[model samples]
Target: MTDEQPDRKESGFKETTRVRTARERLRETVAGHDRTERVPLDAADGRVLAEAVVAERNVPHYPRAAMDGFAVRAEDTFGASDRSPEILRSAGEAASVEPGAAVQVHTGSELPEGADAVVMIEHADERGGDLEVFDAVGAGENVAPVGEDVESGQRLYDAGHRLRPSDLGLLKSVGVREVEAYEPPSVAVIPTGEELVAEDPAPGEVVETNGLTVSRYVERWGGAATYRDVVTDDPDALREAVERDSDHDVVVTTGGSSVGERDLLPEVVSELGEVVVHGVALKPGHPVALGVVEETPVVMLPGYPVASIVNAVQFLRPATKWAGNLPVPDPPTTDARLDRKIRSEPGVRTFARVSLTDEDGERVATPTRASGSGILSSVALADGWVVVPEASEGIPADEVVAVQDWEALP
Candidate 1:
């Protein structure tokens, strides 16, 4: 772990910290920050509200016909029946209805000025320049009153509420064109490795996909992501990349986080700023690191695809939520009995990929066959992951576990 000799086997970490400790440090570092911007209602879907939204005007501000019928005074149609009808003069398309007069109106049309109710077209008939009413009408029946849907000055949404598609429609109905919402956290995703290539890779080279995957997840989690190209395993290059993206709310780097000689992010992060938690006791992604540079959080992830994804969900997801003044909720989970025993270390937290199937009218979770840090298909094809806590060794067969859908957006 000395400066002159780079550690090859153990990656300089004498003892890895627990997963809970690492998450607490990261949450504490990036909490209590606010950034807001005005967003149009059309683009406000999934954005968090910066302030409470109050309606400026009522929905359906004027009384209108709720059904296709004739507008008439309620008293004029009193005691009307199918056998003996009340006859009134027909006032075609009248702006106002007088006594013993009926106005022709359609659904959603404004009620006439003097009209207090509407007699359904089926209950009334126009015959020989007169209207025959066969049913009695209440004073306000079949009319959409003012503020029927939403009252004026009503609180639509409070701060930190995430806007959905239906929410935009309600806002538009209340005459709100835009809203003041917290801006999505900006993220700079850097993929670093000497053997990574953009497209066609040679024998030893690998295609760079971690940056793309992580960047898309950032957007899904309500953040803006800037995916960067691959940087070689050089201290100067890696340091410059980290400094270039220090202005972003979060800097996530995939690869170059292990204890091998090529892993140089830990050293560079320590030199520029403080490393909050370097190595965590988490299976398949324990090499992940958390640091802060110029007050912006930097997350160092393992090069393996599965490991990178695992750490991103555990660390980067919550980091963005805290920075944007949004709610950090848990992912959706389902309880299922284990089909077979799953092994894990006693003190390290493990995320075992499992695919669910119904057997004997019960949901059973079976661990994926290729359960390795480098295996990507193992997770892509699985339904969810079962988390083994740091307390116990592993879950025995027939034990129920919560299968967390890790990719579920918050």
Candidate 2:
């Protein structure tokens, strides 16, 4: 084994602790390199743009009327209201021609020459071809001037922006039909273990479900997922699998991350590539292996379901964002008072499952007992997870803590 490998006892526990700040680990894992590609605007939904999108023309290119009313000078009806009505000739005297005239206008119609404002049709009455206006209108009212919605030569969107429905509408309004966006990164997931089988497993073997979980998350974040056949603790088979799938942006393997006698993922990765970070300082996912195999990033996740998921959130999400030329949003969180006390190690950050409930008009958090990575059911029942940092020993009851809602995942 290389000098970077941690010493593990027969009981599956490490001899020395390897603690790293979340930011440090993330920086060490990602090197900021990215691959770019172009895609059609219709398929660019939720994808990040690699270049800035400038406006070709101003929105609503012409000044137009916003309501169906009489276009007249504000000075014509200075005090015209319900109490005092102003009478004026509808035709040649005030310049009128049915609905399309120099004085009368309809909704969204162009303003006639010499007209500056529109008085609602309801506010005026016909009196022998003349009009009696009761409401006073202001100049430039009910009118959308040119370049009011969008200015000419404006920077509509910047690079690294993920397109949403509203953003698509803005692009369309500005006459942009296509865009240059980065292609999503492709991720290959390899599940390892002898007793583990596919979802439909044989007798005495457990079904492998971590790949499915990982794949779902990768696609959710605009990354492609590729699932490979299972490798049963054989270093040569694992090496071959990594080599075959080296074209992918990221390769994630479940199980065999620790230094157990049967665990050989670390050794295989070292032989094929260089291991940058052998372990993390977080609970339930400390044995994670982060490295690069032939210029492609590889992450070896722990076997337990919960541990695998936590590692994905911490490492895989950021890596996927970097590869796809996207920016990762801050993890969704809400502050709530803790209902019970929770303990943790001083050097390791702990994630505890929690359920939120309203009590006395305030949110109270109730923690779950499934703290281990193997217990997947507990996570299913939890609304979110509360984070405890590395420097703190434990959080006391009624302390406000940040909780991540599981439903926020797409």
Candidate 3:
């Protein structure tokens, strides 16, 4: 523990800790435990490849025609032109086509025996039983040489590579019917609160949504999520839920990390496992917790949407990415000027929702009315946001910032 404690007079949480230090611990906990699986090519999308796929054969294994033309030796068309055309007899089979004769061929068709070039169909005129070439072509012209696209035993993809839709087509073209990839990490989220309800809520009960938020974020990082029922602010119930979900790669419990009498997540985590971090120095997310149970990492997020989403974006998503060896997705962003000034407490990171406007071809960002962490619509209505770091004050009006988008660009 620490000699200095957080000043919780203004905040509601009992514990306080640094955000970066806690995140480093979580990263160490999630590394080096990824699992692998073999799946058909159809199921490889969005999966991290565990093995490299190599080409089995040459693409266009033979010397094939690259256009609809008459196949002939380069010497036959060396000086042929519109002014002085070379008339060659059209022969039937390879055995019948002697020197100075052209063989009929189409796109992708194999070149006839002893033919080293092709005269495009448009450049050749059919005259009775012969083809009159009006344009000269050099050796190997208009022909697809062997291994032109891909060579045999060429490495197509390397391990730790994430598969995309276009990657599937390339894998098929390389003659790979299946692939070995990391299995998606499995996460179990258990929401705990006495005043939370599932489907129908009483007059004072709140509908549980943090579990859904955590689960959805987990899935985005190539992880499978299972949300358990709310544990009702009981230590025993929370412990049971955590123990039951130990088989999963990560166990998450939302709510009940405060000093309130009903809050039992911290106590349950301490009793059933080990609580490494009780609170993070993040605004609207100070009560966050991190622990381990039955060799499984457990993350405790605040019940509020703002805290849950930010923590998920900062913590759970990254952990899942490491577990699956996934490539970090790039979020599209735009540079904008702040519409107004915003302030923050020292040594604490804060996130705010902002709506954007185009002011004379320049984007301006204004803070949204939804400042409370529990206001889901605030974030939904926002175009994007600007995050203030822990060591700084707030941004001044007109200060340009990068607003990260919810989706990445193609």
Task: Highest lDDT: give the candidate number.
Answer: 1
The number of clashing residue pairs in model 1 is: 1
Candidate 2 Cα outliers beyond 4 Å, as residue runs = 1-35, 79-83, 88-109, 112-114, 120-130, 406-410
RMSD per candidate (Å) reads 3.5, 3.4, 3.4
- The full ranking of all candidates by TM-score, starting with the best, is 2, 1, 3
Q: Which runs in model 3 stand beyond 4 Å of their true positions?
A: 1-18, 68-70, 81-98, 101-109, 120-135, 356-364, 407-410
Model 1 C-alpha RMSD vs. true structure (Å) is: 3.5
- Global lDDT of each candidate: 0.91, 0.78, 0.80
TM-score of every candidate: 0.87, 0.88, 0.86
Residue 14 of model 1 has an lDDT of 66
Residue lDDT tens for model 2, 39-92: 666777898887899887787776667888777766687788888888765754
Worst 10 residues of 2 by lDDT: 93-102
Q: Model 1 TM-score?
A: 0.87
| Candidate 1 residue-wise lDDT, 214-266, digit = tens | 99999989889999999999999999999999999889999998788899998
Q: How high is the lDDT of residue 199 in model 2?
A: 71
